[model samples]
Target chain A: MLTILLQHTVFGIVTGSILLLATIGFSMIYTTKRFLCISHGELLTIGAYTTYIFHVFLGWNLLYSGVIGVVITSLVGLAIARGLYEPMERHGPLVLLFTSVGVTFCLHGILEFIAGPSIRSFRTPILPSIRVGGIPLITMNEIVIISIAMGSIVFLHVVLTRTRIGKAFRAMASNVDLAMARGIDTARISMFVWIYASAMAAVAGILLALVTSVNPDLGWTQILIILAAAILGGLGSIYGVMIGAILLGVVMDVGVIFFPSGYRAAIAFALMIIVLLVKPKGIFGGE
Target chain B: MFRRTRIVRRVLVVGLSLALLAGLSVGVARAEEVRFGVLTSLSGPLGTEGKPCFETIQWTVEEINKFGGPLGMPIKLFVADTATDVERGITGARKLITMDRVINIIGPSSSIVVAIMKFCADNEVPIISHWSGSTRLTTSGGEYQFRTCPDDYFEGEVAARFMWDEGFRKAAVITLDTEDTISISDALKKRFAAMGGEVVVDEMVVGGQTTYRTAARKVLAKRPDVLFPAIDLDTLKIVYRELYEMGITFTVVLASNAVQQATMDIVGADILEGVYGEKPANALGSPGYAIFEQKYREHMEDGMVGWFTPNMYDAVNLMALAVEVAGEATGKGISENIRKVANSPGIKVYSYAEGLAHLLRGHEINYEGASGSCDFDEFGNVLGYARIQQAKGGQWVDIKFYSSEDLAEAIR
Candidate 1:
């Protein structure tokens, strides 16, 4: 029982880390932009597929494709913010939310047209498992997933807390009108947020392709859970988002020990509802 | 002036009559053609299954056309891809039935077969599947649903007998949460447990999630000697790879679904070595099947036949044969005549041309198809034999041929 529990925890942490990368970006966007970006999944798909084109089609190195995929995704994120969302900013977040859904379907249709919806995967570098006490615990791909997540989390934390632009981002998110009145470059900050958050999402997407496989539905599958984690933590709070993602992952994996694995997604959502019923603003919302 | 106007009007009336005759002739010519629709994953997760099945369908249809098609009407075929999505399956079936106005339809993968079968049946378009093994396919679909392969019940019995024969007393079962896979899991558990085999772990898992490491570990904790995982090839790819990375290997014998040669090539021999699966023994030494394989090699880039490819061939031929048997081309006609053409108490026919002649001569003919006998039971399932096989050096090699008679006795 002890070994099983420990092993499940390890599985939880690995799943949690991927969710962390996905959730943090989602939380940041909702914090500043104040609308759910349903097309975020397509953003992840674009990133993974771009890397796929590089590795599979062009015969580039996987690591090189990963870097290029992230850069391209961040650019796409910025372009979307400028070309679609920014132009519609005056219409309010509700309209933006609806537009995001439209964007999602459009992107999905386009990707399906281009790629034809077959599942594609990368031939990743064979990584060894880190076994302790003569039992295989976790794979090195999982380790890479966790480390990349942690590195991004740390980077985001520093940028948001220690930099001038980070302070401006916070100011705008708290009150966009007030920040604009105070002569803060709110558009610039929003763009920066879009780029950074999208880069993180791309990183998550590439890692997912490495660990699992990539299909057009990859983003759509992970988005709801990322939203659940972000909402479970206060959407505006970075630490809250991180904690919620890890908790969601751990709860989902460990809960299967008690419940059937088919209800794994349900377990995570049920926890979110219970937490919300107790604290409507979310676990970290009161802060 | 009256005579001149009358002559002009008479000329106009004669011209209109001649045009009407031409239109009627065109309509008669059009009616001489029968349309068949194919709904399958031409591009998607089941592309490996769908494309080959489609190719086989085409080949069968082409050969029939050469021999003067069913009811002596040239067969017109239209294909729609579900892309292995359920919603798309429903849409494709609708388009085929309504927009395309096909008299008969065939194919589609098992995952989408339930919804599409229901849709096709509701529209009075009789549909046949190569991969559908779900009981609900017939229960809900009634006379419209048909498949060329045996039901999960037969598959379960076959798998259990193999496990027990191999001296596996304790089994661990993991299945995807799909209705078909669950049915397989249930059938397998029932058969295995009835034979005094203990099912230590039975886990129904949701597919498409990132990792199943926890579920795999949970199964390992119980320490079952054999594992029977009924999952898609893609999900198994992840599960097997994860287990390999974790240095855990369980003796696995999967359902016929896992008998994918392409998957074995992709996963490689290192992980797949000694993994057992079963496919219908139709590929072995049948003169009819040999011709089909030769044709397939000439047509497809990948020459390795998927399990359902021959079934698709059988489905198309059955669709054509039913038309010949009924002497007309309509959904209701095909639905009524499908069993008569495919089921028993008849002379055995091996090909479309043979079946058509037998039916034309007032003979009840059973189609002993390439994929088995295209023989169906009350539930629209057929009894068939499978070739027990094992993965070695990135390919599936036949271990033994398990006959239907022996399987029946073992299960009974």
Candidate 2:
């Protein structure tokens, strides 16, 4: 029982970290943009597929492709914001909302067209498992995930709290008109936010690929977990999103040790619903 | 804004015209060309399976065309990617049947087979599934749906029987959460329990889940004598690796068809050593398999390794045979003729080339394919024998054969 509990916790934390990466970006985008970026999953797919292409196909170093994939996908996000989202910004938020969905469908089709519809596995490096006192520790990929997730949270915290542009970004998120009145360039802040959120999503996608195999639709599936986490963390609160992500991950994985594995996904969705009923604002929302 | 509106109008007009042109072409195009739709997850996680099916079908179509088509008419292969989406499966099937006007459809491999089977049966379109092995496909009332691969029930029963023969009593089942998997696991559990074999634990894993430690720990806690994990290749490899790392060992680990050569390749030999299960016979085991394997390896750049590739190759050939035997590519005629060509006795059709020759020489060709014999029962299912193999010395060594009859008895 002790071993099982510990194992479950360890595994849960690894999953939580990946979920945190996805949700943090999702939460940030939602907070500033004020609408669901349905194409966020495609951003993840871009990151994963980019990593697969760069690292696996071109035989580039894993670490190099990991960084490059994140960078490329961040650029993709910026492009989408400027080219697709910006056009509809003057129309209405709803127009941008529907356009995001259209972008998602189009991206999905384009990926299918290029990748030739086959599963591609990355030539994953064999990292040794850390063991202590006879208990095997998780893989280095998982440890990297936990570290990156923590790093992201801390970095975001510093950026939001200390930086001038970060304050302007926050002001814009709270009220675009008010921020513009205060001489903050709302458009610039929106672009920065889009780049930042997408960069985070790319990092998350790369980390997910590191831990698991990369596929075109990987981002679409991971987005569900991210959505659950972000919703549980009150949608827009970065700190809350992180905590909610960990909690959602734990509940879905660790909470259902005895249950059949199929129920794991169902549990994640069920937790979101249950939390929504009890604490609609989420655990960290009151802050 | 005016320019944008102009572009939108042009797109609408062009889209409408294309639709109209396609509709008109459908009426004018003669029914001489044998049209078959290959529906599989060509663009999603399961696209690996779909890719080979497409390639095999295309390759078969090319060969048939070179020989002057199925019945002196060129074969037209219409391919669609379902991406493993259930809804997309239906849409692809409908398009293949209604728009493409294909007499037969060959896939979106696996569960998509069962999904499209009902629709095909209703519409009277003969669907020869290349990979999916759902019980629903062969259970009953699926006259139009034909499967070339061994059924899932056969897989489970074969796995269970192998364990039973090995004298394993207590078993734990770890299967995927999907309905297709759960049903097969349930069937295995019921069968194992009926044999007085104790199923100490039954666990499920969601598809696309990366980590398996929690479930592995829980399953290990049960301490069953044997672990019967029925899942896809990707998930199975992850679980096996986790179990190895955790230092967990059972007297036996029984896997289904998913734990074949490709899976064994991923996790390496050390983890899979001594793991026993029922899967399609290795391509090395049969002369027909060797010939196809050699040709595929030589000619194709992106060909799939192991079982399903040849199975799909045979399925495409079987479709052509069905068409030839029926004397026309009508759904009703083709579906009925499948059994006639598949189970024809004393007929020696080793490959598509051979099958084409036999067709020309006025002989019924029994497709003893690379995957297995394409012998369909009254249920339109071929009960192919599952090969029992153990991972040893970095390779799968076939120990013996577990016939479908043995499975039917042992599972019950």
Off by over 4 Å in 1: A125-128, B1-32, B43-45, B110-113, B116-123, B135-142, B265-269, B343-349, B354-366, B410-412
Alpha carbon lDDT at A146, candidate 2: 87
Q: Ten consecutive residues with minimal summed lDDT in candidate 2 chain A?
A: A119-128
Q: Put down candidate 2 lDDT per residue, A1-287, tens digits, no spaces.
A: 67667767877888888888888777877888777788998887788888878886798997898789888998999998989888777887688789988998899888878876445556664444677666776777678788888888889889998999889977877887899999998878887888888888887777776666666677877767777888888876778889988988778777677666666778888888888888888766622
Q: Considering only chain A, what is the TM-score of each predicted structure?
A: 0.95, 0.94
Worst 10 residues of 1 chain B by lDDT: B133-142
TM-scores, all models, native as reference: 0.89, 0.86
* All DockQ scores: 0.38, 0.35
TM-score, model 1 to reference: 0.89
Q: What share of the true interface contacts does candidate 1 keep?
A: 0.46
TM of chain B vs. native, candidate 2: 0.82
Over the full model, what C-alpha lDDT does candidate 2 score relative to the true structure?
A: 0.75
Clashes of 1: 0
